[model samples]
Target: MLASWQMREGFLRSGRMATRRGVWVVALALGLAAGASAGEEFEGKLTFEVVSKQAGAQPVAMDYTVKKGLVRMDTKVAGMSNYTIIDPAHKKMSMVMPAQKMVMEMAIGSVEPPAPATAPEIVKTDKTERVTFNVVDATTLTLVKEGEAAGAGAKTYEGQQYAVKVGDRNSEQWIAKDLTLLAGFVETFKAMAQGPNAAWMKRVEWPGFPYRMVTKDAEGNVLSEMTLVAIDTKSPDDTLFTVPDDYKKMTMPQAPPAMPKE
Candidate 1:
């Protein structure tokens, strides 16, 4: 039989062990909370400037604004404006034409994209690098510019450079892992990259938000380049996602009657 003192000491030691275990549990909980917050979807407006290599082609400004589960895309060039609104949950898309004062509505199918039979190989560089902007000057690839001169007044982030190849097309992306796109938006975007027309996109995937993405052809010639020039975290007005009341609804034009066979 053990003495009272021995029993008391045993209970005290057990109490100490339980206290230490409690501390570990609390610490782990806190760490998990922090990780969840870091991975939360980014809600804001993103502006990407698209540069074309064709002669006499003007640079187009593409703006995407997300708020409260709604997405809006606006493109305006040479006094012509076009807007596309998408509601993923409801599976609806609306094309708002300001010039025509019309809204063309269509139902987007909720098709789940099939997983790629094989994941594309991604190579990451050892060091982080700043994104470079390709300046096109009058039908010529003038210079590969970097720093503020290339993207003035734009937010810059140093990210890991990844080389991604999808079939014949090749692309390089500067991805900032700290920033994540809205989960719903990513799903909807992937869902839309379906069907026979978008087979190439089905093979493309992003690990995180890309600050810059440049796609090149088989010959290494630049095809399309887009850079993120601005980002705003403030929630935009809900009205931006809604069609204007004054706009008239329009149906898709029907195909012309078939010619009679001889």
Candidate 2:
């Protein structure tokens, strides 16, 4: 069992990006509490069978594990490794490579504070009534409202989409017909590439598995597709969020030493 403060700290540290990707594992553990509460506590195991394909080559299979809060991805691909850590609340995330025995930590925050506009865009399309906007640029679109359409059974956003679901406090969500992309989806990738909240105007692509992405290679070979398998609302064990006592603690890379004082 873990202490409450420790759990709170873990929650606070996990940022929007990490939580968006793996929150389902925890949500599965939490069960019904996930529905009634904004952010119900949770913890559980996740097994990911990832397949990647390039032009003419056959798809490659990779297995991954999500235990507690740690993720271990094993593959022979370059620039990727065997271990990673994600914290959603605080916008802090880290990755580790067992072969290199190295760790990288990054602090994540919004690239730009949400615009000062009080109201989101409400549009009444021929099919339905909804609210939507590109918060940072056209890349990050947030759907603030939705109503039924006459003939359409469901809606779908086809391009550059990430995970879909209602978000908790500390984050906003962009919704399309059948998907939800967390605010941190774009924010975290931007922060990792540039710097904390670094600003750029060009449209950047959304990464990882989201509802909108189609798994295809240049030659039109079908890779693997991700689908929403299930959802759980029950509250999970409070201890699921904590770092383990037996696991080794690794340090992130050190920044260059400050220049000697003049």
| Position 235, candidate 1: lDDT | 70
Q: Model 1: per-residue lDDT, tens digit, 1-262? A: 5765665455345334323222222222222233334554435666667787767777888677766556677776676677777665575556677765667665544232344443555678676865443333322111134533553333334578887665555767677655443332332332222222233343356665566677677788886677776556667888898988998664432211111111
Collision pairs in model 1: none
Q: Model 2, residue 236: displacement in angstroms?
A: 3.4
In lDDT terms, how accurate is model 2? 0.30
Please, what is the whole-model Cα lDDT of each candidate in the order they appear?
0.52, 0.30
lDDT tens string, model 2, 1-262?
A: 5675664344334323333332222222222222224432222322222344445543322323333333233333344434344443444444433433334454433223222222222222233223333232323222222352323222234333232111110111122333333322222222221111112201233332222222443344554432222222223344433444444344432221111110
lDDT of 1 at 232: 63
Candidate number achieving the greatest TM-score relative to the actual structure: 1
